[model samples]
Target: MSHPKIANTDHDVIDVIRARWSPRAFDLSRPVSHDVQKQLFEAARWAPSSANEQPWQFIVADRFTSADGFAAMLAALNEGNQSWAQYAPVLVLAAARIEMEKSGRPNQHAWYDTGQAVSMLTIQATSMGLGLRQMAGFDRDKAQIGCRLEPPFEPVVIMALGYPGAPDALPNEKHRAGETQPRARRPIADFVRYV
Candidate 1:
């Protein structure tokens, strides 16, 4: 199947935005370069945060070529997700710490801010010819153990990042069909409520 064609522009901004999509299948054979990963993280670092707290932190486990700690982490993920997620070159555990402490009261905006950071990182990866899938189906306690996460740092999302792979390789027919589907979004009227 032919991939969607993107038009060239002075900066390719429009094409990048339009072509961005979550890809479940990844090319496990190809190891993502450190430079590329660094660039993606750099883009994430600049995302807006409440009060510039910049609370997001990432723990990356390179799963493509290395087996160290990879299996344990994969095991923590839901069995249904393991098939495709195992093929990703990198699995990032996005986390955030509760920053504000006023007489034992924890701030509520930290998670919200961290989510924004993840969105920025994913979009940057998409714009750079890479694919990312944010996942929440995992054993959080096991993941924290496998990823070596400490207290006060709560896991928000687990992300798989790598080059796109053939849809035929998916473990199930449903996933194969989903890989080729066009991007869908809720209608603007459904979301925008003018008070």
Candidate 2:
């Protein structure tokens, strides 16, 4: 069964931001189309970057669309992550350039900029009624080889995307429960400090 709607805390926030959460169980029967895929990346392409240096690249593989693409990427994931991520119809390896192409110097904020891009992508995906789970459980070295990434493009997170599947399909009961669990956030007092 599809998970029941998950509501946000009483605090006010954008509907999309509140609704966005990672889902491990994907309805692999529903394939993500190329057009929708383009839209997701378009959203990422517009995210802000330091000095306008967009340093992120996404290597996407769709099991439902491309032959052997998804299987190849899956091989790069850690054994544990492969268990659940295999169910997702789409897999993406996100990488960030460590140096700016224009300046030819190290870009200290490249990773941070890439995160901003991924955030935009997630919001766009959520708006389109799709779900994604981002995992850092892959070996970076192996991902570099699997993704065929060259120097300067360091792998970061691997994201799985597709339509949400029945929570009951998940092996762990906790994962099923998490699909409906009330989202939590740290209090501002816990992380924010007054100067």
How accurate locally, in lDDT, is each candidate? 0.80, 0.88
Runs of candidate 1 with Cα error greater than 4 angstroms are 1-13, 101-105
Name model 2 segments beyond 4 Å from true: 1-7
lDDT of 1 at 129: 80
Give one digit per residue, the lDDT tens place, for model 2 in 1-195: 423455445578888877788988899789999999999999999999999999999999898777577887898898777878888889998899999999899999999999999999999999999999998898888788878899889998999999888888877777778777766777767987989
lDDT by residue for model 1 (80-170), tens: 7888888788888888876554333464787888898888887788877889988899999988898888877888888889988888888
Q: What is the lDDT of candidate 1?
A: 0.80
Which candidate leads in TM-score? 2
**Residue-level error in angstroms, candidate 1, position 170:** 1.3
Using lDDT as the measure, the top candidate is 2
